[model samples]
Target: MAQRILIAEDNDRVAAFVEALLRHEGYTTERTADGIETLQRIGRSVPDLLLLDLRLPRLHGVDLLKKLRKSPVGNDLPVIIVTGVYRGERYARAAQSLGVRHYLEKPFSANALLAAVKDMLPSCVQVDAAPEEGEPFDRHLYQAFSTGFSGTFHFEGKRKATLSFIAGTPVSLRPGFRHRDFGDYLLQNGRISANEYDYYQGAGHFRSDVLVQLGCLRYPELLQEKLAYLTGELLEAFSGPPLKVEQRSFPLSPGLQLFTLNMPSLFHRGYWRSSAPDTANPFPEEVYGQFVAPAAAFYRHVNFLDLNEEERRFVSQLDGSRTMAACLEGASGITPLLRLLKTFGMLVFAHEPLSVEMPAGMPLRLLFNVLEDETGPGGDGPLESFSDLVNEESRDDEPLLPAEPPPVLPEIGDLSLRVRQVFEGMQGKNYYQIFAMEQGKFSFDQLKTHYFKLTREFGPETMMQLAGEEAGMVEDILATVTTAYNTLSDVIKKERYDELLGSEKVGLGQKGDDIFQAQVQFQSGKVFLDMEEWDNAEKALQDACNIAPKNGDYLAHLAWSIYRNPQHGSSPAMREKVRQTLNRALTLDRVPSAYAFKGWILLEGGQDLLAEAEFSKALKLDARNNLARKGLREITEKREQEKKGLFRRMFS
Candidate 1:
């Protein structure tokens, strides 16, 4: 039988969430909204564990616990305090004295809540990703996707991986640390050939764009394959012998590209390869005659598998006057359901303990399929997992890359000019503006997402794109962003940054056209530009340029508007005037876009050689200059780069 837990919380939402999470982990739970109700329930029906919330409707949680400690019924019951109120050492000490070893603050994660609960009353499976013979890597993936966990998964052993998440979704496999051989993963998996792997290995410096040029690999497909490979690697870590593992809350990196993949769908490849009891008949005749119960709340986090009508009916009838033998007799065509439930370990027989027993032989990748279950209790002996074998060999030899660690990317590592432009523009921007947050909006985690995104992008270690003096400017920009994040993060400093952004709003009736007002106009113009209203952008940017002509960003954007404006004819004369405007803008400040605009005009003028030079200059300043790079690609008759998703485009 699943262990019983009692939830004592006054807040309906908190109570509901905690109850659902505990039930999902295969526990029977009871909820009481007040201390009086809590005592009555605990006394009447003893519980295996209790989740106590301090502030109760009828009686205080602390006082109620005191009464429980004095009584025989409630004494020695394990309790974990899940509180939104009554925090601090005083309250903790009081609870500790009352035999509470666990304390979780409100707004906790599903992982944290489950971890605390599992520590007190572990599930039947005990698949906590340690040395135990558990379901291969699939369970870990299932937990992350199912619970919507957002944090870092860190593990170290013979082989390990570090992954980043956002809102429980896996975004990047490795954000900043190690660089593994993705080609080997592909080659060994038969997605690519040895020749292709060798060629890719030789072209270590080639990026997605150049790979397209060489007709070697398509960037998007390669990224997708790499994601698959990393997913496999992460699974392999847990599939093998014991490894040290630790998890902490961490945000996704903005610089890395995130491609969508249905993570649940990726698990079948690993699950069948895991160690499990082999059975021709998963439900033995002797056990079928006995009573059975749901092994877990398996209904949740199982959308990847659909429920058949008969299967649903069979599950609904598990309450009374039913046995596996009866169900098997009634539903003559439910072999698939039986096998599915068996694979998932979703049913347990009364008084029969289940244990994880590994196959005598070593496991092999892709060796066992769903069909293997039909082969009966003693299927073929397992072979060593193929991917694990190859990966182990690859780590030792690494035929492609030098035995030494791969060198840092010569061009600012992973930091591109596009990334720099995205962050550097927010150098002097206020906390709200930098985060693009509206007035009076704050969540420490939300703020953390924006903060991690910016700081990780402008990391000083990867600022090799800039020279010594220019790099100092990047550092200053990083410092400014750091300061803004710190100020907003602290309750006291939140009142003002180094300077307040009170007068930062534009289009209001403000006094003089100072640099501050020009800044307002500039920001408003950028918003219009993002909205693609060329005329409005022109008018607002014209105001900013008139007030602050030396601001190259302002002048360059105004030139962009002049060129984008439909009223501005596409005649050679108009093009020439826009070209001259960009030249003037570049003289004031050499922003990448001005050179990119000049390059585009030259390209349109059929000055291919001159256009290439301008494009190169734009790239030198900002390698991610889309306009410049696109112009060069057009010159060389190559493919246009794929557009980024709105979030990445706007944020990164």
Candidate 2:
């Protein structure tokens, strides 16, 4: 079966060309003119690969790529960027940041397109061709033989250039076009005349606007001729055949400038070494080149005891020749290997392979299962036996009885069934599907829009009935409706409810025990106080206190509720009791209510001065308190008649 590749390009010509190229390469191609349509097609059935053009009619390429990465289906899909406008280094950097695997500039040959496709598809094979005259040799094929390496290569030809690769992928390319910086450096170092530098920089700019702005060379002819000369010079610097791996020592400190040409083979051979810096080269050794051989060898040889029997059997069939497609054929087992290889970095497609190392001494159980068959039926080895012993011992030491199960009240009966039904219906739908809104991030306004739509669908009466039900599971639905109303009304409690629903744990059922205990404590405390049992009331309040220590209202209520109990002893003792309890309550929070309550107790206990001061303080804090106002009036009288007499006397 051919791999499906989706092409998202607005230009008809480019789309047709890409579709044809992919079809010729044995890929099942699908084309969409814009990002919106492309996304819709992906939702229907996600393609195995995506060939993205950055400049689409509706959505730009970078935006489309970001959207694809954000979606579940398209997140990990391989993307090849095809762009006509070369933004140079800036564009290249952006594409690399997005994890783009391959890039094709405009006017690319069919062969170049095919090479890129081959690089990304692990199952595709490369067909060799001879190098043309003055063309630099391709040394990528020799990468399969070495463990790892990094080095600079000088290309000697009509055009001199330097290339750098990291882990088998080209990271930097230099001396293209006019080599503006390079020409400047040469002039500064006396390698070229000032006149030559000025002429070349100007000439280079005339041919390519970017080069001219960069001030590297003057004329296109000069720049091209210089590049050709530099290419030849670099080629001459390659003392041996194009595909040779040499381990040479640097004159600088060994730690400073160590370089490896092909290093993947070394890792495969278990030649693990710390990659540290040296003085000679600031950059670490680059591990570019083919990794298929080493990856295949590791998969074939490593032992993975952790894998299940089926997984092991799948792995045992991994001979180097079989592609992932072949291995997954006729078996529903390919999904696991696809995930495992991706994790192990052993799965390389058409582009550069990533360098992911398995931790030292880590079991290869997951990796090996996909490569080999299980040993036998009773494969419980020493390690398994030891693990079983440890589990048994831990179990035996655990407490015999488990913690009390949560109260199974009738709060969540048929509501669970209704919620489960809704979940089943919306299983694969986006959140927008439930509310019939377009897919997007959840916003306050969006929440209101959906809330109103749901209200209209379910009807106001049904929604009210649902809200009144004891169904705790319907909290989220209630929250959404509440949020909508609160958005228009600005209600604080409803806003808090909305925040609580957004939390990972839904509903107040988890805290039911705590609430029940607090209720029990308050009820018992009140009952004891009514029965004149002062000590019992205190004990009951203490229990409630344990349940909710931070509640100042509860503490104040407990103090007042126990004040006049007969068991509190005689009047003198009761006076001291009132003072202590009121003092404690006042210390907790000096609210107007607390002060008023204390004033009444003080008045009853014959502390007139203290009582008057407390009432005045309460009234000062809250002018509308009727109790404080009445108390203050009783202590002082009005003088309206006296004022009238004084005014009449003054006039006479």
Candidate 3:
């Protein structure tokens, strides 16, 4: 069925262009010229996809995206964002949180639009086909696609098959089976001795099937023994329903397959064993033997003092015979046991009761505690003990022991009061506000003007002392002020304030011209780029680049605007300029926007593979990037639609 697409563009021309393109692809599209109509149209009948513009009439694109996510139908609906304005990290992060799938900057191609749509579609399947019946399970193939499944299945015949589906897709085919057949297969393969199998059954109390495979008994005798045991206990334990195991196959390797088993619904609620057959082991004794020895060995080697008293007592009480719940009951709580066991990687839960083995020392508990203390209610104080523990553990020459705590700092009453005073005065004001300028939008001249006025009143040394003394304040005043100064002066705090703000404003009045001229030139360059005049853009961008040679965006955009002109579009000089600009931009900040533009240029220059790689790189850097999404989508769709037939070749 043809999918319905909605284009919410504020510009009439852009909307018409998109509508025509989608129509040519046989998709029914709805168009809205503003955000208000876009929301209204979606509310009436949600489209499969939405093409949103960042700047729209009535409501902004960002606000609309938020509203769409909250709406029931729009929550999972894919959206492609289109914008002209340069959205930095803040906007990109917000769009990503709202689940914008693709972004298209100005001058995006039709192929980019189509590519994005195809990538986000529900029907897209990217994995290779599952191995045929009788083929060995492949581990590599299983991990290739991201999937979540829980089920067990039984295969009727000898063949192996593959299974694939997205979330919520109904699966009916049985891919594999679970049975006592493993023992027979092992015996046929000569991996175990019959005497060893008998010893395992007699002493280890292994399952009959396992004993049979180990050569303890013939298959017929093992089957009879299993039947007799089942007659007395299995009927009661499995009485609720026959075990219905569902299977899903995942590619684990080129030829190796791994299967996820979904046992009966009874197992889903965390019940491993039933009450009537309490004496009947929930898992095969052979399974218990495989894990129990290692588990005991691990317990013996573990240092009890390293664990809390509660954990020590819990481990000491665990005997091989006791189940996890029974051990928890004896210990009075399962929390510590579960935590310690899981932390060490010694435990795994499955259809049977939890199993444990001695594993490599994990120290995951210590790591978790450290991370928790750093982020938890007590803040950094909790991390002190964790840090000490780590230090103590790292010393190889000495036996591991608990670390001594650091000495607490003495409280300073008057100094604390002074710190409080500095913080309270500067608390609400950001660095820009401190200097009486708007945040984010300010010229060097405006910044300098504010800086001198404030410093003259406060005196440079006193101001520096205040900022330094209150550096430990939680309000982040020092950082804000430093950032503001860096943005404006392009000089370190010590130097800028000492040379400029240290002097009296009256004395500095005559000195403002040189500062003002530098500021004017810088501001004029920004204005030129915004206005899109190539000559002015080049001149201003060059000046900005020279002043802040490390600034990649300025270099990139200057080169980009220059190349946009038809006269310079194909010039070798233009290409070189753009290459240098892009290289610098990448160096300054390999931000999604920079990569998106670079990818677009590469794509236009017939470097499709390089363009795709760049786009992919951009997406990796910022998943919420609309430009990268558009580029990726364009490439993907074009590849998928590329003709392989003789008719296609002939037409081309």
Which tens-of-lDDT digit does each residue in 1-652 have in candidate 2? 3466778886677777776666555566667766666776677556667888765555556667778778888777778888775435555655776777677887778888777777776633223624424321323312422223344444454334455443332223355312324555355334455665676567654233343454433343234333433332223222112232222221323343322221222221111011111112211223122222125435433332233344344444443333334334444423333333433455443233334334454433333233222232346532111122123344566643357764444433233445434534543443344555443344557655765555443332222224333222243343334333444335574344345334343234575666576778878887886786778887777667545644544565566655656565443334434544455455445667557767766655444345668888888889887767766665343223423442333233
Q: What is the lDDT of residue 594 in candidate 1?
A: 86
Tens digits of per-residue lDDT for model 1, 186-217: 54334455565566667744233333455444
Off by over 4 Å in 3: 1-138, 141-515, 522-536, 548-652
Say which prediction, candidate 1 or candidate 3, comes out ahead on lDDT.
1
Poorest 10 consecutive residues of model 2 by lDDT? 270-279
Most accurate candidate by lDDT? 1
Root-mean-square deviation of every model: 28.2, 31.7, 25.9
**lDDT of all predictions, in order shown?**
0.58, 0.48, 0.49
Q: What TM-score does candidate 1 get on C-alpha atoms?
A: 0.26
Ranking by TM-score: 1, 3, 2
lDDT of 3 at 645: 28
Superior by TM-score: candidate 1 or candidate 2: 1
What C-alpha lDDT does candidate 1 achieve relative to the native structure? 0.58
Off by over 4 Å in 2: 1-8, 11-147, 155-161, 165-296, 299-316, 319-652
Q: CA lDDT of 433 in candidate 3?
A: 64
TM-score of each: 0.26, 0.21, 0.23
